[model samples]
Target: MAATPEGYMSGFGNDFETEALPGALPVGQNSPQRCAYGLYAEQLSGSPFTAPRGLNERSWLYRLRPSVRHTGRFDKVDLPHWKSAPCIVEHDRPIGQYRWSPVPIPDASLTFVAGVRTMTTAGDVNTQTGMSTHLYFVTASMFDDYFYNADGELLIAPQQGALAFVTEFGRIGIAPGEICVIPRGVKFRVELVAGAARGYMCENYGAKFTLPNRGPIGANCLANARDFKTPVAAFEDREATSRMTVKWCGKFYACEIGHSPLDVVAWHGNYAPYKYDLRAFSPIGAILFDHPDPSIFSVLTAPSGEEGTANVDFVIFPERWQVAEHSFRPPWYHMNIMSEFMGLIYGQYDAKPQGFTPGAMSLHNCMLPHGPDAQAFARASQARLEPEKLTKTLAFMFETRFPQRLTDYAATLETLQEDYADCWAGLEKRFNGKP
Candidate 1:
């Protein structure tokens, strides 16, 4: 089938229906006694059967073969770099603010799945209560290899290059400044469209990432629901010796298969992969004076079932106006209960104007004091109070309620800025009792 322009269907969480072949999908029923085109009917569920109707997520698929035909005897495999949670590797690294330069892409051949290097993990994967942050450096595409994670869904943020995700639902192409999410337990393979690709990935082990409730800001701004694009029904019917890998409970298992698993001719569901452009995000901040909390810039939030707390909040700081009168433009120095892992996509972040470059990252654990560096603070404190625009900057945070544990690979990376704390050294004590 030919690729569609924009190659996607719009809207988020809307039940969608698509069929590559005419009269392929069964009408009036999810499955029929006899299928059209001699295809098998299968159901994929993203939530429990007893879930509330509003939260229920399931999909019906008409494919060349049922998913049961996509596997054989399972054999354990090793993907050393892809670590999961409850993964606290003992190291000499201290518990404090840390920063790292852009990690160089590996020279050896690495596919999307094989290239995943876990930088930090929070909560526990076994209990399905936390998330893992990873950096992927892909140099090769999966030709006959396919993979799926039964543990959790993946939220991918591309910082460099583009990727074509060939999945059971359809094909989705994503590039830098864009994000794609693959639902848990969906079989897919990644093809590098830019020769090589580098990106950040968040594996959510709790609830799925959904649009945050816009109470006073209303529904029109901050990631409109219509902007999220889910791919239309498309599939490949190729017969060849193939391998399928499964990541379950932090362990990897491989199985042999004779054909591609992405053979779905038709599908109708709310549970599907989707992509969004980060530039489309509508930001709202303080209009008069004083800077609002970064929560106002949240693009999506995965709640931890507790009020005012998030399992993980995917927040971004994009290009916007700085017009707060008599205020410190950059973020202020304060300790937060929520742990933060920040990354730069392009341009400079106002908070750390010096060392934080694109593809670089910093971590501040729970209750850790962090804010504008010495230079950023001095400039913002003394600069004129006229209207200013922060152009060409895109920074984001993976803010979580759980403290993140550093992976051994992350702690040992040559890019780790050991002197990250020195940024606060220049803060002169201006305290005086006589006010």
Candidate 2:
């Protein structure tokens, strides 16, 4: 028996219970008692990570099982049109078909967001997808696998708990406030490493993100490439019953097996798990003149197929100085290749006037035309623009090619602050006589 290490014991002291469905789909029998760490060790040591192909065995650690009743909920909507062209899941076929469709969306041209469901059939399978800018919030404990886009870009932000992210590239124990970006197609798993981890998942289904165009601002302004760190080559192999779930084409399924699915013996690629501490972001802005477009603060961006068109742009406006002499403090009205879905990790966003709180998200479809609310515009226009640091606020935006649709669960979620729509109401417009 392997005894728990003294220091590491704290990490495992949480409420990690197991659901012993001895013979669930793919692998029919429950696997031997092994935590995610044990499985990682076995892979590091050279053992098959799956059950002997023919043997049927399975098990899952569903951390988010019981917390469905406590948290706030989204106001549900009805979006029947999305049922047909839903996304696809090509992994684990035997388990059965899966269903994923956005509950309802305000606009059809923007996005499609939905909860995920899956069943099992065969071996140790992990379903993965390269999704767009729609952030995911799992209402239930998702027994599944994860992967990055084809290029191996992984940027996952969890709202509630932590996840044991295992991959052929490397492994990371992540929680809220921290995010992981695995370049497209780097095989990985989403194991609930801690307590009921109910959180949001944002898939930027946009063009590959690149540095913001320097334009006249010159070089080394926004996001520096050196801040990005991709994982080096890593592999795992072990023979045991492990379940692999895959989400493809919009459905979820599973495959049974008797080996570790994270088996990448010797692979080399630029795509891998890399993260940038938002706090480390270098925020550059106008210290003397009017505030520039938020594009000046973009960290990474995925452009659309069209020139200068962005599929998704991961931009952040962290704590920074505000000293524009005759400028509007908040983000100015604008439209571009991207549809913006904004979230506040913590602190106030300069763009909106009010009601946009932490964890609250708002979407402005491409070309929809939006900007600072009335109250904010009035305040900034009247107040003296002295140099002052707007500290302790970290807001982010998922500017994508397609508009995002909210899940039925998300839209109808009682926790969905009904007052959000009223924020824009405060933005009073003043037309000049010249017009």
Question: How does residue 313 of candidate 1 score in lDDT?
Answer: 94
Q: Number of backbone collisions per candidate, in order?
A: 0, 102
At residue 334, candidate 1 shows an lDDT of: 89
Tell me how far the alpha carbon of residue 370 in candidate 1 is from the true structure, in angstroms, after superposition. Answer: 0.4
**What is the Cα-based TM-score of model 2?**
0.64
Give a tens-digit lDDT track for model 2, residues 89-155.
Answer: 3433221111222222122122112332111111111232123433443433323233323322446
**What's the lDDT for candidate 1?**
0.92
Candidate 1 C-alpha error for residue 259, in Å = 0.6
- Model 2 spans with C-alpha error above 4 angstroms: 1-131, 136-154, 175-177, 192-199, 205-207, 212-215, 335-337, 417-419, 427-435
What tens-digit string does per-residue lDDT give for candidate 1 at 157-226? 9899999999898888999899999999999999989678998999999888899999888758888999
lDDT of 1 at 204: 92
lDDT agreement with native, every candidate: 0.92, 0.47
